[model samples]
Target: MVAYKSKVVERIRLPSRERRAAALEEAGYNAFNLAADDVFVDLLTDSGTGAMSDDQWAALFRGDEAYAGSSSFDQLTSAVADVMGFERLVPTHQGRGAENVLYGALLSEGDVALNNTHFDTTRAHVSNQGAEPVDCPIAGAHDPETDEPFKGNFSLERARAVVDEVGAERVPLVIQTVTNNSTAGQPVSVENTRRVRAFADEIDATFVIDACRFAENAYFVTRREDEFADATVADAAREQLGYADALVMSGKKDGLVNVGGFVATDDGALFERCKQRAILYEGFPTYGGMAGRDVAAMAVGLREAVEESYITDRIEQVRELGAMLEAVGLPVYEPVGGHAVYIDAGATFPDIPADEFPGQALVCELYREGGVRGVELGSFAFPETDRPELVRLAVPRRTYHREHFDHVAETAEAVLEKRHEVAGLEIVSNPAVPELRHFTASLEPVSAERAAAADGGSE
Candidate 1:
C-alpha cells in the first residue's frame, strides 16, 4: 500500500486537548488521520450510525429513493412526515442557511434563544439573524466519554434567568438533547427537559429542541441513568421529543445516513415560515432540504435511530473510550454522556498558559503526529474567553473499531510524553459576517522556533 506519513517532523495541535500548541520535531510525533492508517480512534464528530443488513437499507429504498427524480417536494414532505410522525409535513431548503433566516421571521431582533448548548452553525445562524444565543446548561450534569446518562438539561433557574433578562415575550428557548456540545458533551435529563419546557410555557416562551444527538442522548437517559433506568430507550426519546415546540437535528449525526436534517414542530405558522425558507435553500417545502437517497436513508435511519439496542450500544461506546482515556491518566471529562470525549487541554497542559491556546496546539500536535483530524474545542470552536479551553473528539457512527480507540490511547500517551511542548493559541482576528465562520478561528503561531531551539536543530 502507498503509505500515508504518520510522523510529524514539525509541531502540531492535538484536537480536544488543552490548547492548539505546535508540536516540535523533537516531540516524536505522528499523524492521526484514518487515511494514514495510523489513527486507531475517531471521537471528534458524532457521525456514527448502527450497522444494518443491506436488505434493511434496500427496504427503506423501496419506500424512498435517493433522489427526488421528479418527485414533488410534497411527496418528499409526506415521506418525512410519515417517518417522523408529524401531523403536517413540510420539508424545505433551510438547514444550510443562518438561524436568522430560519428563525428571524418568528422572532424579532434582541429575542432570546435559550438552550443547554448551541451547535456552532445554529449559534451562528441565530446571531446572524439578530437573535441572542443564550446558553444555560444544567449544573455538573454530564461526562461525555463515559456515557454517564443525562446531566445536561436546562435549569428552571436558568429559564427564569432568561425571562428575567429578555422578558417572556421576546425570548424563545431551545433545548439540545444528548451532548451539550459546549459543556463537555453532556446529555440533558428528561426531567430537566420537562421542567424547562414547563417553565417556558409559564413565561409564554416557545421551547425548541435540538435533536442533533437525540438518539445518543436517549441511550444515556434511558439505559444508563437512575431516573430513566426503568424506561425503554424509545419511550424516553418519544417523551423528550414530545416536550419541544419543535426540534431540529443535524443530518450527519443520529438521523441515519450522512446527509439531511429535520425540523419538527406542531406550529402551523412556524412550519409555514420554515418551509418558505427551506424551499429557498434546501429545495421545497414538502421535502424540506434533502436529496432523494438521503431522504430514503434518513427515513430508514430515523426509524432505526429510535431503537433502544442501536442507540444504547453507540452511546455506551463513547463512554467506554472516555473511561479508557481516564484510566490511562489523561484528564478526561467526568460523567460521560453521548457522542464525543472531551479532553481538558487546559488541565492536560496546565503549565501552558490559556493565552497560548494550548488546546489548539494540542489539536495541531495530534494531527501532525497521529494523522487524526478531530476538531479543537477551545476558541477554535467556541469563544475561548467565554468558556474554558477544550479539544473535542467526536465519534462518528460505525466509523471505527476497538483498534482505533487503542491508537488514540497510544497517541495520547505519546503526546503527553512531550506535554511541555504544548502551547496556547492567541486569536489574531475574529469577524462575524457569515454565520458559520464562528467555528474556525484564525490564530498566531507558537511552537516552531522554540522547539527548533530546544532541539538545537535550527532557529
Candidate 2:
C-alpha cells in the first residue's frame, strides 16, 4: 500500500454527451486542443499531471528564491547526485528546455544525433538546431503485438551501420530514452545501455541517457532482467546511469512534481556550455526557468520516485490498466509499458488508412463516447513517417485509482463496439504549422455529409 494520504480533492465533471460533441467540434477533433474542464478523464499525457506527495508540498515551504546560488538549487543538485549519480545539474523549466540547452550547445549544422527512439519534442529540438535526429529502435518495435521483454532497447547493429554511413565524426551524440516513449513506453535493459555506451566510446560520441520515467524503467529492469532480479530499483537505476556520460531528464515524470527538469553531466566543459545556453533561452544557471519552490519539490520527488514501494505501485497500476484494456479485447501493445497502454489503432480500424489518421479518430471517438481523453502516437504525431498507428492512454502517477481505469476500459469498449461507424480525420488547419502539427492542427471528418449530420459539426 502507498504510505501516503490525499490531502485534497478536485471534483471532476463529466460533460453531457451533447457538450462533448460540441467540444470535439470546437476543438477540431484534436484532444490536445480540448479544455481541461470539458474532459472527464484526461489521459492526454502523464507529464506534469501527477499528484505530488505531502513531503513534496512540505519541501516547497523551504524554498529560498534567491537570484542566484539558491539553497533550493543546492537541494536539487544534491538529490540528483544522490539518485542519478551525476556531479553537475543544470535546471530547466521542463524536459524540452533541457533538450534545447544541451542540443543547442552540442549540435551543429549538419550534425547527426542517434537514439533508440526520439519523442516528438526531442526530434523537433534536434531538427530545430539544424541537425538530424536518427531513430534506431529494435526490430519489431513498430509491431504492436510483438512480445519482447525490452522493446525499448537500442539496436547496436543499426547504430554501427549509421555510424559507418554518417562517419563517426559527423555523429556527435548517441542517446537512449528509458521507457522509450515513441514506439511504446517500454523499458531499456542495462545490457543495452552498456553496449550503447561502448559503441559510443568506439565512435568517440557522447552517450546520453534521455530519461523521464527512469524509476519505472528501473523497476521493469529488476522484474524482467535476470541479473537485476535481486537488485533494488534504486541500485539498478544508478547502474543504468553509470554507463551514460550525461543525462537529460524531465523531472515531471519520475520527479513526481508538477514542473521541472534538468541536464546532468560530469563533463565540466560541456556543462559550462549548457549553462551558457540555458541562461540565454531558459533562465539563470541556478534556477533555470523554474521557481525555487518547484526546484525544492523536484528534489524531494527524485528521491521518492525510486522508493521500492512507490515504483512497484506505479508500474503495477499501469500493468493492471493494460490488462483491463486487453480484457476489453483492445489490441494493446504487448508487455504493456511503463506509463501508458498503447492501443493498436491500425488493428482496431483496419479500414482507416494511415494518411487519414486512424489514431486521431479513435481518440476523438473515445472522448465523445465517454469523456475520456487520449493522444494519437502515429502518422499524426510523426507525419510522413511509417510507424504503428497507436493511441496512448497515459495514466498519471498516484492520481487515479482502479475505479478510474475501469471507467476508461468501459469507455474504450463502448467505442470499439461501434468501431466501423468511426470515420477518419483530415487535417484542415494551415499547412504552414510547425512539424509538431498535432498540437495545434485543426482536423475535420473526411465525410462532410456525415459530419454535417451531427447537431454541431464542421463548424
Q: List, residue by residue over 52-102, the lDDT tens digit for candidate 2.
A: 998999999989899799999999999999999997989999999999998
Per-residue lDDT of 29 in model 2: 93
Q: Name the top TM-score candidate.
A: 2
TM-score of each prediction: 0.80, 0.96
Clashes of each: 92, 0
**Off by more than 4 A, model 2:** 430-434, 448-459
| Cα distance off (Å), candidate 1, residue 60 | 7.6
**CA lDDT of every candidate:** 0.61, 0.91
| Residue 272 in candidate 2, Cα distance off native in Å | 0.6
lDDT, candidate 1, residue 306?
Answer: 68
